[model samples]
Target: MLAALAVVALATVSGGAAGGWVASRDGAPGGTPASAAPVPAELVTAAGKTVPGVVSVLVGGAGGASASGSGFAVDDQQHIITNDHILAKGRNGSVTVELPDGRRFAAEVVGREPRSDLAVLKVPPSAGLAALPLAKPGATRVGEPVLAVGSPLGLPGTVTAGIVSALDRQVRLGDNRHSAVQTDASINPGNSGGPLVNARGEVVGVNTAIATIDGNGSIGIGFAIPIDQVQQTADTIIGKGG
Candidate 1:
């Protein structure tokens, strides 16, 4: 079964070719590709200025079955990016974004891409939205420091720091395979969909999951969807193909 799974994964990555897999450095499981280096610190602080536009998402049903996660505005027109699982319950839900100034606004779903675990949302510009610039995902490097900003466990504006543990990590989501950026950034349950910014504050990834030992908390291993795929998925969602 494992060999069959590997064959299927190779086929998917190679687009039906015989040898398709995520490119890695030195044949390591979590090595950086020969692309770009880490972002500088000054740039990260400047980028941090935009976190006020990141918001918490609340999905609910008619009788109030709900789940919550974090997200950030990506475009000036109130377009936001988040995890598709955060909105998996369908569109009959509402999102609330808390600005840095302690203001909040309601939002709606624009599009979602479950294959990539990303979702785009639309809220009024009056919500005081500030969008973060997307960094090149191919540039991520192992050992680089990163910061994750989100409402972890429902605590708004929580910030955590860690290093990029690896790059080009492959993980399974439903029937689809995803290549992600791995970090030791201490992401919690509510941290899903938040931005994982480099030292320069540019968004290199979106916090997705953390490895748990005893079903408790992070064991220094976490993963985020790469920003490159996030941009492509967001574009498709904006085009109404979520």
Candidate 2:
């Protein structure tokens, strides 16, 4: 029976008939009416632990154009992981990173891998830099609940929640081609390079790009560089300075 159908195609990522799936549902198994459970207190505490590692990144280019993005501490040595786009144009000028406690630092690019849109930056490690843990093996799966922590559109300390929409999705931005973890998280311009965290407060992905809905805002379709790739790339950059 062809019931009321809803075909969810990849809308803006690729301008083509990029295939879709039939969103058909049967019936709830249980007879009792169910109510949504309130969010757990542990989730709130997880966010509290994660946000301290997130930082706001501001870039100023020599041509006078400026941009803002997000990043998070990777280690106690002041190593940071963020989107390469944030440091793309500002290489010749200044890249300022601000912490959750209002401390700011001048960050220097250690390495940038544009293929994955990931970059590594460094500042002198001090007392306040806290490293957020990356999700371990077998820690994630499709439909798993997650959170996006970043500074969206210049507003810092922002956190949004959603579930993993899809996995191993491929998309391109400029010359960068990426296999991303798709989510319905509320990611925006400044959210790039921020952490896409799991419910366990572990960094699972790097929030990269979003598919625009209302002419340049998030309509809950966002893409992220999976943390496995982020970690591999970061280590190569750090150890080899490549």
Candidate 3:
């Protein structure tokens, strides 16, 4: 009954039988210090603008299987991006995108590149959605301040702040290798497919992987796919998958 109730919670967020999953795409970091700038009003404002564009990704598959995670808007046409592995957890079923405003929509996989560990999803454009801005290629710099927003442990609207620790990091997810942006953010299982935004609310990377010690959880080490890769794959998916 408890497990069923959890499924109900996810499905309710999806406004249907489909649900979401929360897993992170991050790994261990170099344990470097974060940016020391005092919290500015702009960072606060950025958070306000960002949270609305992110959504909980719920998926339901065969035999009552379900999972939940996080994702963010990339464009005005209702295209959302998430990790391919996050969506794979419920491959037997369908995907659901649940917004912060209590609106829900069914999601379909438009394109998936397991090699890049990225996937794009499509939902109906029912309202004027402000797509989060993606930074230009090579926009990330070490010691830059960043914020990670996602649902951790099924907690929605959760936010954690950190700094860019490194760049051009090669991390492996299964047989796939990706050059990633490293951060000292507190990313966890549920943070996958979300955005890692700069202090100005511009997205620099997609929160994708986290390194855990003993499989416990995040220890201030996380990785994100650079927005450049996100754009390349997403454009291809939109052109072909659509």
Clash count, one per candidate: 3, 0, 24
lDDT of 3 by residue, 1-242 (tens): 22211000111222222123333445534578778767778778889989999988888877776777788888999899887777676763788788888788888889898788788988888844579998888778999989999876666677888899999988877777788898998877667888899988999998888765444445577889898998898899889988
lDDT for model 3, please.
0.77
- For candidate 3, report its TM-score: 0.83
TM-scores for every candidate against the unseen true structure = 0.77, 0.81, 0.83
Indicate the residue-level lDDT of 43 in model 1: 48
- Tens digit per residue, CA lDDT, model 1, 98-176: 6656776677777767788888888786886778888875888899888888866666677788888988888776677
Indicate the worst ten consecutive residues by lDDT in candidate 2: 7-16
* Local distance difference test scores for all models: 0.71, 0.77, 0.77
Given candidate 2, what's the lDDT at residue 161?
Answer: 85
RMSD in angstroms, candidate 3?
9.3
Candidate 2 global CA lDDT score = 0.77
Which TM-score value belongs to model 1?
Answer: 0.77
The RMSD (Cα, Å) of candidate 1 is: 12.1
In model 3, the runs with Cα more than 4 Å from the true position are 1-38
Q: How do the residues 1-242 of candidate 2 rate in per-residue lDDT, one tens digit apiece?
A: 53332212111111111123212234445567778567767667778989999998888776576667889999888898998877764543577889988889988888888777788988776636799999974567999888899877566788888899998888777755678899997776678789989888999899988775334355688888898888999999999773
Backbone clashes in model 1: 3
